[model samples]
Target: MRYLAGNPFSAVTLPATLAPEWSLQIERALAPELLRALRESLDAHCARPGDEAAQCRIARAAIGLMVDSGLRRAEAAGARRSGVKRVDGIRGQSMWTLTLVGKRSKVRTVPASPATLDALRAH
Candidate 1:
C-alpha cells in the first residue's frame, strides 16, 4: 500500500494512502521552535544603542522582509541593491515596493512593509 501510494503513476487505489498527511505531520513535528526566539533576539539587538545598532537594524529589516514575503536570497540581495521605491498603488495612494530581477531575468516586484521601507531609508 505504501509503495503504491508513493508511486504517483500507480493505477491501483491503496487502502492506506496517507502520504500527504504523514508528510505534513512529520514536517510539523520536526519544525524548530528556536527560530522564533532567535528572531526576537535579533529585534532586540537592533533596538540597542551602539555603533553596531545601525547594522543590526538593517539585518533585522532584511530578515523581516524575507520572512514576511518569502523572498529568495537572490531577490533579497537585489532588493537591497536597488532599494525600495514608492509608487502609486491600486487607488493612487503611495505605497512601497521593491523592484528587482529574479531568475531567468524576470522582473519581479515585492511589496515592502513599513519596517522594510524605514530600514531601506536608513541604509
Candidate 2:
C-alpha cells in the first residue's frame, strides 16, 4: 500500500514489497558507466564540425547535466524550455544555474559543472 500526504511534495510511504531482482535490474540500468558512455557518445556526436556547432554546444551541456547529474526528464525539459540564468557571485565570480520546478512542483537548483560551464561559454 502507498499513502500520500496532503502536500504533494511530501514523500509517499509504500510497503517494501518490490522483488530484489527487479530492484537489481533498475540499479544496473542506471549504472554510472552506462550513463557516462551515453554522455560521451552524445558529446562526440555534437562536437563534430558542422554549421550547427552553436546549437550542438548547448545540447552537449544539457546532456551532461542530465546524464552526469541525474536530472529528471521534466527538470531537463523545463530548464531548456524556460531557459537558464547567469548570476554573479561574490567578488564578481559568475556561474550558470537553472531553477527547475520538479516533482510535485518543488523548486530545485542544479549547478553547472566546469565542463558544462565551458560548453555554455563556447555556445
Candidate 3:
C-alpha cells in the first residue's frame, strides 16, 4: 500500500503500488473450523494457570489475530513484542491496536477486538 515517491532521477527502482490492491474485502463470516480453533486456543490459554500464562496469552492472541483478522502466518510470526498497543480515545474508551512490520517493511496498525485485548491483558 505504498507509492513510489515519483522521483524520476532516483536510481532505486520500485513499483508505485503493490498489484491487486483493489481486491481487498473483509469477509462476512469466519469459516467454522477457523472459529472453532480460535475459541479452543483462547480457552486453553485462559485455562492454563501460572507463570506460563504470558506464553499462552501470546499464543492465543496471535491465533485469534490471524483467524479473526487478515494477518498472514509470516506476518504474525514477525509481530514484535513491543507492537501490541492500547489507545485511549474520547471518553476514556480504548481500542486495541496490533502494530507490525507488514510486507515490504511497512508498519501498520490493525484494530483488534476487545476480547482479543482482554485475552492479551490476562497474562
Candidate 4:
C-alpha cells in the first residue's frame, strides 16, 4: 500500500488500523528422564547384531546430534564423518566440533559431546 501510494502513476491509500495479532504456540521439550530412557532403549536395540541393529545405531546417532547439538532434521541427516574435527579450546584442551551446513548454505561449527561423537563413530 505504501509503495502504491508513493507511485506517481497510481492512487492508493494505507490503512489506518494495524493488522490483527495472533498468539504463537510453542511445544514443550521432553523431560531429561524421558530422554535417558529413550537413549537406553535405543542402546538396547543397537546391541543386537543385524541389519536392524545397524539402523538403530544410525537413529541413535542422529537423535544424539539433534538433541545435544540442536541440529535440524535435515542438518542432522546431512552430517558427515569428515565434518567432525578436534580443535583446541580456550583452555588449551582439545574439544570435538561438528561442522554443519545449515539453511541457506551457511556453515557453522557446533560443540559435540563425547557420547554423541562415539555414537556417530559407531554408525
User: What TM-score do all the candidates reach, one by one?
Assistant: 0.57, 0.51, 0.56, 0.71
Q: Clash totals for all models, in order?
A: 0, 0, 0, 0
Q: Which of candidates 3 and 4 reaches a greater TM-score? A: 4
**Cα lDDT, model 3, residue 34:** 75
lDDT by residue (tens digit), candidate 4, 2-107? 7665657456665454332232122455678998999999999999988999999989999998777667789888888899999998878899988867755667
After superposition, the stretches of candidate 1 with alpha carbons farther than 4 Å from their true spots are 1-39, 80-83
lDDT of 1: 0.64
In candidate 3, the residue pairs with backbone N, CA or C atoms under 3 Å apart (3 or more residues apart, or in different chains) clash, namely none
Query: What's the ranking of the predictions by TM-score, best on top?
Result: 4, 1, 3, 2
TM-score of candidate 1 relative to the true fold:
0.57
lDDT tens digits, residues 13-66, model 1? 746322211111123221245647756787788778897888887787777667
For candidate 2, lDDT tens digit of each residue in 1-123? 345535765587865442211111133246678767866776776778886766777777667666544566677766663446777888999887666666655566666667776665676
How much lDDT does candidate 4 score?
0.80
Which candidate leads the pack in lDDT? 4
Off by over 4 Å in 3: 1-25, 32-37, 41-58, 90-92
**Model 3: per-residue Cα lDDT over 66-115, one tens digit each:** 75557777988887758778799789998777877667666667767877
